[model samples]
Target: MSPRNSLLLVLGMASALLAQGPDLPIDPANSFKVNLPGDGPLALVSADWGRSSATARGGAMLVDLHSTLVFKNSSPRPIRGVSLLVLAQEVTPGGKASVTVPSLDIQSGESFPIRVDLRLMRPLNAGSGALVQVGLDGVLFEDLTFYGPNRLNARREMLAWELSARRDRKAMLSTLLQAGPEGLRRQLLSVLARPADNLVMGMQVARALPPTNIDPGRVVEFAFLQFPDSPVELLSGEARMTGTEARAPRIEIQSKSKRPIRFVELGWLARDEQGREFMAGTLPADLSLPPGAHSTIRRENTLRFAKPVNGLTAYPSAVEYADGELWVPAYSSLKDPRLAAALPASGEERRLAQLYRRKGLEAVVQELRALR
Candidate 1:
């Protein structure tokens, strides 16, 4: 931008910040700006400049921003997800951050909320305008149509979330249709009673495994839990283990179904010495394999578990086809007794149950109806 335009833009932003109520903790010049395209599928309804700060550290500025942005779905279809791009350093590509909210079921003209919490580091005396600029990166509709520049690959991620949400919702709606309210209650109770996802303490994820603190470990051959409708087959795989870390992992698999597979995620699991199994995060690999074609998925970083694992196993957790469609473990498959503690409640399940708890059962029924 030219210097004349920059001066006007900065002055306008400063004046707007000063117009905010008094006793402001954030300096006007050090604040951020919201820039939403007027012709997009979503329209900015309001922006609340919530708590924010800019502290000088050495020759740089530490900017922390927290804001609530409300947007209306101006499109004709229901929105499944929204991703906002937060640009803290316009010139530096790495300084960009993205916030994506998935599993949304917003209808036309419906308003939704997005919370932006970001921390950035930039030169103390930096560019014009606010310290950050928030703009729309993408929006995924219920029909799989996407809007905006997909700079962050929001299309695939949003579609995956939508697919999962739809699958879980269909299962729940079917339960209600077949068994009535009592049966549905039993199902929700079972889901709510399952063990919650555990947080692995001191888990450090890196592209490569640590060299030191090696455990006198042996090679671990992977095992798989077969799903009836799985489109891919795991042939063979193993990980090099050293004490608590596993590295140089490799797995071979072949597509068994007709669809062209594009993305694969393995449900990595580890069994501790105490005879208990815990989820060891997912191994995501990009593939361009057709039906009956085999490929090897390799990772440079070896397997690093939060704790010493006695055994390791994997299963196809989710898969995406080349057509932007997804296939997740069947709701029934995920309900297996062995997987009860491994996977958390589905997004739709948690959402419906929360609605039922807060607003009663009828609200959930209405929501399911609207979704259908």
Candidate 2:
């Protein structure tokens, strides 16, 4: 953050009333408010609004939201994910925010927490009546179903994370069963100690067709990173690329499964000029491909970056069936030596690592077993 930017934390609540912290430097009254429905699959249990403040800088204002909310799975199904909408300033064009909690395994009648943390800027004259509004955006259940508004496309994102969570847990459990506690400990330690991948090379994406008759680079065919469990088989794929941009991605696929596919997201790993590879973004397409059928997915979206990229490898990242069931790349496939370095840790992996850090290895093991 720059020196001119300020951050204030919105922090407390229990049950039906909102709780405030002590010694706060008095922000604008009613600057932050949270609205949650009581009749949803997950009911609001409590909120610990930590401490929130608004700072005025001439005609602009900075608001910080950082808090944890507690909710219970009041419905009969397990909750896989949740998303909370954070309204920074209703008057601002892009002032909205969302907090999504994925890789959750909260069973019926169980309690879970969602943490919201973001720094937003708004006009000072926006209003004193709730400078920020927090509400429900979406929730995903264990049965591959969803509740709440589908505003943020949280359904697919959460489902993908949940699938990854399940994969990670099973993978670690397999390690524990085969090699015992020491081996499992080593595995967890390795992930916890692993440093984050250096993916700092930036990219600008435009969802429109690339400019015609321009310096669009040569055509590049994508190399496949095949997964045995993937529902779709990649026949061929290619994209137009320049030193600073990749555009007009087109891929042909065949459904190998009995169920029809409704959605598929392809992720590519690109190598920079320095030979360092990073996960470039995903290209999600919503379509229908029946069993033993072939289809082609195309997009005019263009991705531009400062550093040149080689679209080295492409893989199936997320796939959803017509029945609303989702499929993610298996953990075993992601553990390939080729991908182990480029791929980032899943949400559940991060949670387990944090659990080990805060509560010890035994706690993680116990949680994993309980979830199982």
Candidate 3:
């Protein structure tokens, strides 16, 4: 698959939430915000059951519900992620099941499709046809801020968890500051042991500092390759590498399109003079540049590296705009292995993947199966 397509696949696999429904499709009109504010509206555009099947598994009947869910952004700004509280609208007897949809980036007025695959065991005394009910519990923005009616109280629950996580983070930072290097590894492992529900903590750990903090004076320049049909131009920018952290203080872009540009993401690749290369990270640009206007993105987000290197030059691997448009490496560009390898993984991704790796898939399955 092409890199952009691969990115879409990775995003789907990485950011899904759990939920469920019935054999028949339900009208999305019934799905409403329970406690959300009137601002930043997100709509369930549609929901349909694509297929269903039943089979005998060890003496119980196993059922599978495959579905397609469509969501639209009705708000003014762009959205990077969504969280829903999906419940089994109706179930006969008592069957256990869960549903999931990808966390995604959605531009204003744009709609996207997410595949829902649910599995449950048939209840011994249950009748045919189960109904699934879903609600908009919360919405996550690109800046990590959250909003929604929160009918399921997920926001409140998450807030409680985050508060606890903050305490834990403060303690860990204290350990790093006082205990010094010898006692650090044990704390790192302990932090990694936390559950995925501690989302904020997981993100912090991914960007955790190395035992020895060193700020090298090495500087790297960013080269621009504009989108094939893009009206935006990358004028100038550079990033400084200190230890494993890369910081870009200023990135300038010029817009020539009639429509104002609202967002842009530049994929970073670290290539040393020796040709050794790997995926570095991404620079996300949220802007409001009108036609013929130029915007300078300040150094705010920090990109992390697996190891320190020298003589690096960064390039754009992917780019997205406000008008529900995207720019990624063309299929032919994949011929250059370096461009193909720079798809950066976020810290949260590294933490959670490590969680699954150490705790096993069954642990993850159990966590998602719970209705909390």
Q: What is the C-alpha RMSD of each candidate to the true structure, in Å?
A: 9.8, 8.4, 23.2
CA lDDT, every model vs. true structure: 0.78, 0.77, 0.51
The candidate that achieves the highest TM-score relative to the unseen native structure: 1
Quote model 2's TM-score. Answer: 0.76
Q: State the lDDT of candidate 3 residue by residue for 258-367, as single tens digits.
A: 77666665655555445565555455666787888988877654565555545344444434456534444443443345453443323333343454568764443343
Q: What's the best-to-worst order under lDDT?
A: 1, 2, 3
**Candidate 1: worst-modelled 10 consecutive residues by lDDT:** 20-29
Tens-place lDDT digits, model 2, residues 117-223:
78776776665567777888998988778998877778778877877777888888888778887888888888777665464346566775655676757898988
TM of each candidate vs. truth: 0.84, 0.76, 0.37
Q: Tens digits of per-residue lDDT for model 1 on 308-347? A: 7777778998888898677878878877776766666777
lDDT of 1: 0.78
Pairwise lDDT winner, candidates 1 and 2: 1
For model 1, which pairs clash? 215-243, 246-302, 246-303, 247-302, 247-303, 248-302
Highest lDDT model number: 1
TM-score of 1: 0.84
Deviation (Å) of 17 in candidate 3: 31
